[model samples]
Target: MNVILIGYMASGKSTIGRVLAEKLNHHFIDLDDYIEKKEQISIGNIFKSKGEIYFRKLEKKYLKAILENENHVVLSLGGGTPCYGDNMNLILNDANSISIYLKTSIAALVSRLKNEKSKRPLIAHIETDDLLAEFIGKHLFERSQYYNLAETKIVTDGKAGTEIVEELMATLL
Candidate 1:
């Protein structure tokens, strides 16, 4: 089975997925990292060089490839992965996959993301906390529809990585 983790940016998908994969004895694949390795460029660079349209296309292609070919894997998707193309449907339609949304509040996301904006291409230009918060609020509201379709939802606010992992393990069982 493949466990797909989806959520807004800074929602701990990759962090929790690594531990979850260790416990489940599954391979952990961060889709962004997978794309970087395949494209030989950072996701940030991908956006800068090829543009978001191109990046999203690559995301959709690689996402389909991974879902179709991988097994016993914990895959963490990019923030906008499900919002583009038919990616959510592809994930939902897969019989061997379990989709989990690591839901995080906008305030929590703002706090977590403020320090790491440079690492994220989408919000790197957001200069102020108020603007960052506003962006997150609007973006989360927009993306919630796609994210909520996940087979499982786990709230990650005020939770440690291990606690989230434990909750995911229990949910998986």
Candidate 2:
């Protein structure tokens, strides 16, 4: 079976996916990395040189390809992955895969993302912790609709990666 981990930026989707994949003996794929490799450019560069719309189309294309071809793998998607196109439907309806939401609170997300804002195009323009918090609050509210479509939801506020992996294993088993 495949596991798809979805969440807001810095919510540990890629980190959890790596550990979970090791435990489950599954291959791990960070969709952004996958896209970067295939496109021969960094995700940030893609957004800068190409644009979000082009990147989203590529995201959809690659996401569907992975879902169709891979098995026993953990796929960690970009923060906005589920919110675009029919991607949420694809993740929810796929028979061989389970979609999981790493449901992080606004405070946690702001704390995690503030220092690393430069790395994230979407939030890079956001200045000040207060503004970041406000942005995350509103963004999470909107994205939660798509994220909640996941088969499993795990909160990562004060949990370690190992602990989160255990929670996911329990659900998957």
Candidate 3:
């Protein structure tokens, strides 16, 4: 089975994905890193050079490819992956996979992402805590529609990584 973890930036998709994969003994594929390797460019550069439309196309193709090509893998999707094209539909329709939304509060998200904004292109231009909070509040509200479609949702607020993993394991079982 493929375990797909979906969430907004800094919601711990990549970090949790790694630990989950280790526990499950499944390969962990971080979608952004996968795309970077395949395209031979950073996701940030891809956005700058090729634009979001092109990046979304690539994201769709690879998201599909990875699901089709492997089983027993933990795949962590980018923040916007489910919001683009028919991607959420594709994820929902897969029988061999289960998608989990790492639901986090906007306050928690802002706290997690503020220091990491430079690494994330979409919010890199944002300045100050107030601006970051506003941006995240709006973005999370918009993105929650797609995220809520996940088969399972895990609230990650104030929870330790191992605690979240334990919850995930319980849900999976």
Candidate 4:
């Protein structure tokens, strides 16, 4: 079985995926890290060199390859994975996979992102409160439709990591 976690940036997909995989005795894969390792370049660098269109094509190919594995695993997808291509459909078609969406408030996301703004290329340029708000709002609006297609949705606003994990465990089990 494969448990896939999907959500926007700062939604705790990677952290929760690691814990969940450990608990379930399954392999854990973070899609971004996988891409970086396979392509031998940072995602930021990929975007800089080849542009988002090329990076997204690579993301789809990698996602397809990973989905072919039969072993039980927990996969954490990139924030924008489902927003482009047929990635969401590919995930949904996997009978052994269960998709979970971590729903977080814009306020909570903004607060969490502030701490790691330097690391995120997409939001790095967002400086003022107004700009950040607008940036998040626009991106969220674009991504929410894809995120909503997940098999299960859990709100993580203000919740501790373990708390969210527990909720996910309950739902999955």
Candidate 5:
């Protein structure tokens, strides 16, 4: 089965996916990292040069390719992957695939992002709490529809990695 992790940024999709894959003995693929590896450029650079539309096109292509592979994997998708294209439909059509949404509170997300702002190209310019909240609010509003399509939803608010993983395993098993 292909386990797809979808949620807002800093929701621990990649981190939890890595641990989940290890425990389940499945291959773990972070879609963003996969794209970076394939294109040999950072996502920030992609947005800076080719623009978001181009990056989304590439992301859709990569997602299709990865989903077609037969190997069992835990794929952590980018925040807006399902919201943009036919990606959500493709994921829904796969019988062996299970989508898991890591739901985190806006406050928690803001806190996490504040600390890691420098690493995130999209939100790097957001310097204040008000601006950060506004940015996340808008993005979350736009993406929630796609996120709710997940087969299972896990609330990750104030939870540790092991705790969340255990909950996810229980749900999947």
Candidate 6:
């Protein structure tokens, strides 16, 4: 079986996925990182060079490849992965996988993302916390429909990494 972690940026999918995979003795694959490795280019650069439409197509292709061909894996998807095309349906229809959404509040996202804006291409230009929060609020509103389709939802505010992982383990087990 495979475990797919879905959430907005700074929601700890990749970080928590690595630990969850280790605990489950499964391979960990961050979809964005996998794409970067496979394409030999960063996702940011992919967006810059080929644009979001092209990048989303690549994302859907690679996501389908991973979901169809892999097992015993913990996959962390990009923030918008499920929101595009038929990706959420694809994920949901995969018989061997379970999807979890790490639901974080906009305030928490703002706090976590404020310092890391430089690292995220989407919000890199957001000048203030207020603007960042506004952007996140709007984005999350739009994306929540896709995110909520996950089989499980975990509210992550004020939770330590271990705490969240433990909760996840309990749910999975």
Per-residue lDDT of candidate 4, residues 51-143 (tens digit): 999999999999899999656989999999988989999999988899999998888888888878778878888887667877888999999
Model 4: how far residue 31 lies from native, Å: 0.2
Specify the poorest-scoring 10-residue window by lDDT in model 4: 125-134
Query: lDDT tens digits, residues 11-81, model 1?
Result: 99999999999999999999999999999999999999989999999999999999889999999999999
Over 4 Å off, model 6: none
RMSD list, candidates in order? 0.6, 0.7, 0.6, 1.0, 0.9, 0.6
In angstroms, the error of model 1 at 43 is: 0.8
How does residue 172 of candidate 6 score in lDDT? 99
Which residue pairs in candidate 3 collide? none
Instruction: Give the lowest summed-lDDT range of ten residues in model 3.
Output: 109-118
Q: lDDT tens digits, residues 1-173, model 3?
A: 99999999899999999999999999999999999999999999998999999999999999999988999999999999999999999999999899999999889988998898989989999999899999988999999999999999999999999999999999998
Candidate 4 displacement at residue 20 in angstroms: 0.9
Clashing pairs in 2: none
Candidate 6: tens digits of C-alpha lDDT, residues 106-152: 99999999998878889999999999999999999999999999999
Q: What would the C-alpha RMSD of candidate 4 be, to one decimal place?
A: 1.0
Worst 10 residues of 1 by lDDT: 61-70
Candidates in order, TM-scores: namely 0.98, 0.98, 0.98, 0.96, 0.97, 0.98
What is the RMSD of candidate 2?
Answer: 0.7
Order the candidates by lDDT, highest first.
Answer: 6, 1, 3, 2, 5, 4
lDDT (Cα) of model 1: 0.96
Q: How far off is residue 39 in model 3, in Å?
A: 0.8
Each candidate's clash count:
0, 0, 0, 0, 0, 0
Q: Which residue runs does candidate 4 get wrong by more than 4 Å?
A: none
